[model samples]
Target chain A: MHYTVKTAGDQSIIIYFGEQISKQTSQTVQKLSNIIESSGIIGVEEVILGYTTILIHYAPTRISFHTLINTIKAIIMDVDLAKTDERNTIEIPVLYGEELGPDLANVARLNNLSEQEVIKLHTEPDYTVYFLGFSPGFPFLGGLDERIATPRLENPRKKVQAGSVGIANHQTGIYPVTSPGGWQIIGHTPIPLFNPSDDNPFLLSPGDIITFKPITKIEYDEIINSQI
Target chain B: MIHIFNVIKPGLLTTVQDLGRKGYQKYGLSVSGAVDYYAHRIANILVGNQDNAATLEVTMIGPTLKVLETRKIAITGADLTPYVNNSPVPLWRSFTVSEGDILSFQGYRSGCRAYIAVAGGLDVEETLGSKSTDLISEIGGHHGRRLIKGDTITANAVHTNKICLSRRLSTELIPTYTKHVRVRIILGPQDDAFTAKGIETFLSSEYTVTKDSNRMGCRLEGPTIEHKNGADILSEGMFMGAIQVPQNGQPILFLSGRPSVGGYTKIGGVITVDLPKVAQLKPNDRVSIEKVTLDEAHELLYKQENIFKLLQASIGEGGGL
Candidate 1:
């Protein structure tokens, strides 16, 4: 398959390799990301990577839209997406169930599995970080066991507390901040996934593989109060 | 010295805002800032402040502020019947307010959101290179929350006895609120999803901004746009003025604080210059949509840039309120 680029807004361009989400599509998207970042294209402020698309934001005053698109297209065509190098595996600790996880029972009941079985299934597989979006430091993690797949709450909670781990469809993520959310909360992570005070705020980045390690509430609090 | 005051009565949702927070969106962070970015930029320029300077973004209902100190200030965006010390303050005109003067804003007579820019700008902790408040993440601005009663905002260190530009812009240059509004738009990546008739209806139909509108998006109540194929597409990147049609068929125009992306089908996007028209649209305000080519959009932005150049040349560059 080939890639296509389209104008998003006055100052942004959306580049896509495929229409659907797949491993190959993600690879293509990552390849595009690598090319843009390493291409040293001036005026390109940031390139947002997604499931199958990459949003390139540029400073309109500094660079024209045509020049940016052409520069990026040239870089994309020259880069080989098959070269996946330096993928990091990260282990994230989660305090599942009890007061930390308000919807753990609900998710397990919907999947016809006990709470313990749900935990075992959730932590058993290593998930890939598709991309970061929705809120600051919120990761769209893939590779969840389909049996534990659950739909978001019909009526979204007015507020989903920060660090609340949740599952939706085949993807699972953690809420970095309190906002109105519909995701089914299954657990909570005590670690500060996003802190503005720190130089490198986000704990995970795209192309990084993540595995969940079950921890107790005491461990959660200890980690939260302490440094990462 | 610059002064920052508190909200004696926060009319609706008033918060600190700047240009935006970029680079952080990839980490799922929202680019939350002024709902009307054009207005935010113009206000910053009018006050001789940096484009990313933090200012007070007042929603539909304006707030009552207690002036903490004497400072130069300018109010732009919406006409909210603003008064300081029981006297009407000129809109788009830089002026000084003495300490202990009560700056109160009543109901908005015109637009949905208004911006108040101080001469030296508001002093706030910057996060990720911006002071923009992302309410969803609770990370920026004055503790990442709406301005409440008795909140003391610190101002930057710079004081001037007189503003750089003492002249006020002509009424012809300033936008006026009316019942009829026409916004220019560019057709979208998802225009194929809607039937031709659906597109026509969207263009011709008269839509009214709902009362439920906010900084996130302006919900338009109008003719239901039906799609030819009922397919659920994955969420994608969305920007300010992007008109998204959900399953319910109602059109929602994304604003400044909208999510970085969405999954809904977007039929078109409002032109960058015309977004101020969308910004000024209030509840019950009827708006008409007009389609324009990409070339036209570029020309419009260019024209706006020329106007800024002219304004700066005529108005002096010393300092602005």
Candidate 2:
């Protein structure tokens, strides 16, 4: 559990667990995040977990940067990476092919597989939520089946609608909001990934497990219409 | 009762802002707030409002607001040359406007943005515990967007104290904006990713703020920082004042509206004390970064906070007007 801490400014410090992204690395990052969060250190505002880093934003007036660093260092020294917490598993219903996923055929063509095979491969493995980024509630997922791994579109779309599930290279994620992006679209999810009015705005968090369940177009319509 | 102001002209990018939403960045929510926090605080202080009271953050151009009710207000930050009923009003001071009085600006004068704080703050529905607008996500502020013509904004009911109306910030306390601004910064979470020469280029180079700059970030067109390895890193949480260098080598200085996380390598982050100066800078302004230790950054912040305390004390003594 080797790590390095660097000062972002007077009030924030970024703790890098490892250089690259891996489940093992992310687990350590999440554990440290959980510990620091529950520590109740005064002036500690928020602990934001990334793929392999934890950014701690604090109030310098309440706690000195040096003192906060010492407290974090002491906490990290005693942390056991093997300690795991119960995480929530979320099932997302996605509609594949045709208008729902305009680039599904292209993905199948690029991977030299039928549309059914691509869909089967995408759903087989349970992907891990690396972190939420790019847009609100948008998850950056890992553990995409390499067999269906395809490059992103050379030119990104001007606007990608919310609930559009996409893949870029070896990663797969759902677009929680409508934003201009470069990922290759594969399907559309009926569930709202983000709702500002809800008690919990995001459906997923770091260290959560996500499994995409394929559904027919009529089922997607039924889900969408039922929500309204 | 709704104390409202009708918008005659909404300026370029007028939006309601406060101290910003907190404890929600982990959900990928941005902590959108007033960019010029120093000015924002002063404006609120002048009108005897709480520090986090919502105010209108006016950009280069100023909005034309028609008073629907008599209200006490204060203007701070950029000198947009605001006038009430065709008569000019002073900056960094509190004043009262009567019913039917129209407030408008002449044009851009000094800084890039200004803060207009009413006595009770702009009464807008708070989203995620903040009145500040997240322009990217379109979630908060006045309908989660910028002010436009025909928009009517309400001010919360406040009992005005005549004594506070005489308040004015001392001349020395008001900040001045210039084309060439020197900002202090503390080097990196990923400074090692760059070569010594790259670090030198970043510190020594004079970067001009590009038009592409916005609340999200200030894109600088200057010397290309040579990366020791590739510029991309695994996406990590980003903070305000982060100097992120993309693959093209151009540096983008993240501000209040920056995303929760990013993948580009950041060389360093600007000290909190100097962010107001960065906020006041307009496009085409020349900015030079000065490297300072984290201790110095903390000391500077402490000094600024002390000055604020002094200002509050002086007002209590009835010295300022």
Candidate 3:
């Protein structure tokens, strides 16, 4: 993958993979991120992975910008371009509609479909977790069905509950923490994407494949109770 | 051994902070630490603690504490009229407190936040290698929330009778807090997204800090900076001190609790040395932004860091008053 390096700040630099978002780009970005992370290169403070970029925050005291870029360039030369199906396919259980997911009704009304029809379409696709952002373990997933796409709320809510499954345009995501958000929520998931106490903390990662499985409210309660 | 302090009144907003939680931004974690890094560092230095020792970050108002044991403590950054048993104490110096001394703060004199560092650092359990509190995430530092009344703080009690007591920082090393501040910035990765007029307006105009400002970020009210095209850009990683101009044209300056990534076009980043000043800005405070080369930013940082080196030698030679 051809990339361009640009200065993000005085101590940080960004490496761009491509203009468009694709699984291939995420693969390349993740590949380089893993290599550099495990490489234990000096001066590297933090390596943040984006959909189509990698941002490296380094200490200028330990290594110069030119030296850091040169080191990345050499590592990129030996990167594997072949795409492998090593991504994890995790199925998430969700309870659709009702109070927790107030916007589900609006989504169906906007698409001129029944609530059951919307649920059917929502569960069909094996969505790709493009990246983790917005909050900890909050995955910005790709591959939402366009037929049920809904726009965001005009005025954002004061606090959207955690575990809220929302849709904005063609994208869908889960809220790991309760924050002021404008996304049109369609459902609630029993499984938390973020658990700060866990060893991994974040349940999803870039390139992981996830599919939403519809479940009853009782089932959701059971899962939640079991986890506790 | 550990020294304990009971919170009689938690004041406006107070939390434990250190340098910040690093290497966790990849999981979208916000680094919620001391906004005034320089002050936090100096407070720790004055009390002979490591740079990353967790300290209490007191906001506009300050907390009232009942000291439970004799320990060395230093207050730095904002002047919040701290008092011990109704008598005023000095800032930027370490002193011994009696077991029952009433440590309290009266009013804000200058700056926005103050750091109180005890000799042995706070003994809070680290969540993800940090004692800093992230209020939004509700993790780390006294249960990831601001200090409340009746809350008790436990600190490691190290004997520091020789090195730190009565050691006041030299006059030249302290920063002056003012209503208006000139902040230096380094233009960066997305500067071209803004128009020449937009860049010119941004540089020329004076902005007022809005009331919505916090540890997360401050929204600036100023001239609308026009973008060359649209205001939105492809989502990418963001950092502290990033001046991101949104669709409304007003710039939002992210601080210590900035999100890991953003989609807005950032015009520039506040220089590292100037970040301490940025953290001290109060609501409605006026700010003038100036540009400097990256080399100058790095040089200023080195110059600021050299103060610690000089202080270490000076303290080692003379010990203290």
Best by DockQ: 2
Candidate 2 residue lDDT tens string, B149-201:
99999988876554245578889889999999999999998899999999999
DockQ of all candidate complexes: 0.60, 0.77, 0.66
Worst ten in a row by lDDT for model 3 chain A: A78-87
Q: Enumerate clash totals for all models, in the order shown.
A: 4, 0, 0
RMSD of each: 2.4, 1.4, 1.9
What does candidate 1's lDDT look like per residue over A68-133, in tens digits?
877876787677766776888988899999877989999999999999999999999988888888
Off by over 4 Å in 3: A83-85, B1-3, B160-164, B309-321
Clashing residue pairs, candidate 1? A133-B28, A135-B28, B235-B263, B236-B262
Using all chains and alpha carbons, the TM-scores for the candidates as numbered come to: 0.93, 0.98, 0.96
Instruction: Quote the positional error of residue A180 for candidate 2 in Å.
Output: 0.4
Docking class of 2: medium
- Candidate 3's error at B260, in angstroms? 1.2
- Ranking of all candidate structures by their DockQ, best first: 2, 3, 1
Off by over 4 Å in 1: A38-40, A225-228, B159-165, B313-321
Two-way lDDT contest, 1 vs 3, winner: 3
Please give the TM-score for the first chain of candidate 1: 0.93
